[model samples]
Target: MEAVLPIEVEIPSMRVLAETELEEAEWAKQRCEQLNLIDEKRLTALCHGQCYQQRMARAFNARVRHREFKPGDLVLRKVLHITPDSRGKFAYKYDGPFVVKEVFSGGAIILSDMDGTENALPVNVDALKKYYP
Candidate 1:
């Protein structure tokens, strides 16, 4: 005996199964394409990141005015955390009108007190700003 439905009614399970198989095949194809493109995508992302970094560096360098210090130049050193001031948070941000005793090839300088007492440590030029007085 054969199962029968009304002429207007149709079994949807077969169509649904076929549609699901097609959908799965399409998904697998897309996944394979993505896997194949993964390396190229990573390289493109890396190139974009490097380009961004270079652009940022160029913009930064363009705005930067290089500071140069010579021996005998007077400058103020930024107060560091290692050297806490007695005044605490309200303390002055910079430490001296110290004299530049020695200039190094690298951006470092030796500082001296007004009395010409030289500091043993070398300070980065970034930490020192010129003292007008």
Candidate 2:
């Protein structure tokens, strides 16, 4: 005698279960692919951000031009706070009316006081509002 299914009913049910398993495997594979795609997108965005920052930095540096002062040039010096307590006080205020003794490449201007005391002061070109004749 040969083994046989019970009225051929079990065969159909087993086939259905196999089909379900195959579908689950396909779903898992698709999920993995989606995750990889997301990672790739994030990497691309990071690279673009870095490139943008570099471009902006280059443009900012280019827009600024370096200037220096020459000896015997009259320049005004802004008196900054000498000490922490001197802020917002009438004493130790900004003093200028000095003469330029030397200049550096990065807009640094050396000024000499009326008493012939010289000090190197870094000043922006834009900060100098007037030039004396």
Candidate 3:
């Protein structure tokens, strides 16, 4: 970084090297030119990376569907593989017919059984689907 410095400034190094007055000025000038070139390259690289990321994000979200359900709506809760209902190969992925007892902020849903008792843990809306049957 010191090599790209615009002014004739003393550069401290672990392996100390002495610099003459004219040599120091020339080195400083070289450093100044290098600095601008490096900055332009850095800016171009950053902008290009950001644009690429945004393009990928747009493509990914293009087919994204939001999980929207109202309070009191019947919905299906997803059954995670960690706690599958059965050990068989044909275990159901979704285990609901649960009623949406309440809708909380930040997409969390309070769920209840057919008998109307709320479940222990509130479920995220994305983990649920509208009950078809």
Candidate 4:
């Protein structure tokens, strides 16, 4: 009786098969090392991005001037474009020399007309500038 090999082709030498397996193992090891390096690079990039954002924020904050309004101070309120009385190009940018009626902690202030009538809504300090006169 003749013995049958699993494969139809002539059998490869044991030394050749051993060499092929060793080459595959080395390639896999190198690939894993490369993946680790890529992960490290990604983390470094993330850290650099966060530091850049913080620097930009600090520079922006440094240039910003804080506006404060006290009760009884006169300020000019900015006119809204959505107002019914706005003219196309010649409209006045500021509406009033309104008096600050009440000061709120978080930069909100209640405005009053010259006649002592208080506004129903609170306005942000940014929308008003100190009246020189």
Clashing residue pairs in all predictions, respectively, total: 0, 1, 1, 0
* Tens digit of per-residue lDDT, candidate 3, span 33-108: 7677778889999999999999999999998998788878899888866554476767787887998888888898
Please, what is the whole-model Cα lDDT of each candidate in the order they appear? 0.79, 0.63, 0.76, 0.80
Question: What's the CA RMSD for each of the models?
Answer: 10.3, 13.4, 6.3, 11.3
Name the weakest run of 10 consecutive residues (lDDT summed) in model 3. 8-17
User: Per-residue error at 20 for model 2, in Å?
Assistant: 12
Clashing pairs in 3: 4-31
lDDT tens digits, residues 11-84, model 1? 22334435546576665565566566777788999999999999999999999989999888999999877454
For residues 1-133, what per-residue lDDT tens digits would candidate 4 score against the true structure? 4444543113323344454565766655755676687789899999999999999999999999988888899999997656676676788889899999999898899999989999999998889999988
Distance from true position, residue 68, model 4, in Å? 1.2
Looking at model 1, the pairs that clash are none
Model 3: CA > 4 A from native: 1-28
Worst 10 residues of 2 by lDDT: 7-16
What is the TM-score (0 to 1) of candidate 4? 0.75
Question: Measured by TM-score, how close is model 2 to the native structure?
Answer: 0.50
Write the candidate numbers in order of decreasing TM-score.
4, 3, 1, 2
Q: How far is candidate 3 from the true structure (C-alpha RMSD, Å)?
A: 6.3
